[model samples]
Target: MSKSILFIELNPGMESTGAKALRICKNMGILTYVVTSDKSFYDSSLGNPLNDAEKVYEHRTDLYHIIDLVEYIKKLNTTHQFRAVTSLSELYVEQAAFISKALGIKNHNYEAIKLARSKYAWRDFLRNKGYAMPKFIFIKDINGLAYVPDEIGFPCVIKPVDGAASVAVSVCDNLNELNVAYEELINYPGFGRGITLNKLAIVEEYLEGDVYSAEYVVYKHESYCLGFTDRIISGYPYFAETGAGFPAKLLNEKKSKFYIESIINIMNFDNCILHIEFIEEKNGDIQIIDLNPRLCGALIAPMIYEATGIDPIKTLIEILIGDEPNLKRTKNRYCESRYVGAQCCGKLIEVKGFQQENLKVG
Candidate 1:
């Protein structure tokens, strides 16, 4: 029987990763399929995986409705059997876990994925494991603002319990700022249609340290830290990420391998790729900030591959199909990525500098 893999959603911005995965599966003679509401699935002009996939399934239902998505996949499976399930997006990681479970395919722990997706839950899990973490509280609504503890006092961070791409994440130094940030978050417009938003937010003590991400892959209970990346975020009260460079300077010194390994072992993450964010204090303390149970989004994957010839996206596809990935590095180089956001609300007037052959616009 021919094998097939189901991608829950080809997350926007990471279309290159999804397309590459589909192409790899096709080259291996395995069928490729995608289920997404993204209009790009039908418009090749915007770069669609449909060009590489055997079929494209459309579902407008919210990803939070796991049962509906699972049932939808089950119906699709009656015609096309899927051996494994995966997603390139963090927003649908939980849904992909449930669908994989429903299809009896190998996947990350569903409960673990749920906890990893929530900053509050993951912090609690790490605390329970005796790991040092920032003091935090869960806020359901504005009224819960009173519960923000004194110890987690001024200069704390506030972010949605379930969020991605640093959306709706902010830092407040006082009660007034906290209140204003809370109000703004509740009305944040980025939450997509049909998807249920987590009204709850995590208010935690802010840590003073340099930020970095440890990227790793877990297969059959064994974890391997591919490397680390130095995350450069916008200055001050806002924690918007600007760009990242790899391999992280600390990784070059080889001091972080033990800590990264310990974190993965304690978390017991399996059959998945993970991107863990942490703070490195000047005093040599490392505290985890976020644990993402999916491939590192943005250009991190390609950046890693450019630095070290091991392709994480391809390895993830291999794991999905029950194959051991060759994580060996065949080359070494330095890579970095930056995001260019519009400085003002205006139309494009002129372009410059991108005409160079060595530069890529997007």
Candidate 2:
């Protein structure tokens, strides 16, 4: 039997972390198989990342359904000896855990994955564990929206319990705004991949101050804090990330360490990368806001590598497949990943300016 890895659904479209990982696996002679819902997603011009994959399986069942995904993988398991099961997509991280468990592969802790993905559950878990977290209330039904002001208060954030890409994430200052945000959260659909949106939402007290994401690489029993990445958020009432800077500047050394250590010790993590998002208070205190038990994203890999001379994407793939990765920093510099948006969403007509001098496109 040949050794193989069963990759769960990958981040589609432009982000190429999934593509880069598959290429590395191919180069290292690790048989790779990607299971996705839509095969054409990886078949597009930008989807060449799948070219390096040994095979791509498009399952007929809904990718959002864990049991269905597990059953599909189990059938695939009989044909290929899978050494590991993983997902590069944050939305599918928890699902990958369940599939790995069903296949009896050593992976991240399932319960911990659940806690990390569910926003309300994670905040409560951290709070119970003595970590200072933002006040939050889970609204399973629209009727619960009325309690937002009394429970979490004004100047809060209303977001889906499990959401990404800042979809339906808004800062509400009053009951009127809160109601508007709530309706948007409810009307907003899921990933459109056949999975029904959870519809459950969370109204959380908006933590004040700057936000940063810290990546920790957990291999064996020790976790190496990769570095902190600062974020450039868009002008609000709404919270959508615009850009990120590596090695957060003006970081409160004591509070940052305190928060980072809290994350490492509090979560039930294993041999996987933990992408924890946190807010640094003006009073020099830190509060963890979001947690994703996986590598940050596609663009983050190159940014981190250029900034510190370490390839976290490769490191993530190696560790997930039960292999040791070289985690040596050979460069000391600053790298950033920027997200450019336009007035309207449409096809990429032309993107220029990379030809300019003094700009290292990573």
Winning candidate number (TM-score): 2
Q: Quantify all predictions' global Cα lDDT against the true fold.
A: 0.80, 0.79
What TM-scores do the predictions have? 0.92, 0.93
* Candidates in order: C-alpha RMSD to true structure: 2.3, 2.1
| Model 2 RMSD vs true structure | 2.1
Best candidate, lDDT-wise?
1
Candidate 2 lDDT over 1-362, as tens digits, reads 55688787677654567777887788878899988777665556654566567988887434356687788789989899789888787777788788888888875578788888888888888789787667888899889888887888889998888887678899989998888888888888667545445889988898788988888888876778878888889988887788999877644766677667656666768788888887887777777778888788746678898888988888987887677878989999997777777878788878678777555554
Clash count for each candidate, listed in order shown: 0, 0
Q: Evaluate model 1: give its TM-score.
A: 0.92
Residue 349 of model 1 has an lDDT of 88
lDDT of 1 by residue, 290-362 (tens): 8898898778888999999999998998888888998999988999899876868998789788877568876
Candidate 1 global Cα RMSD: 2.3
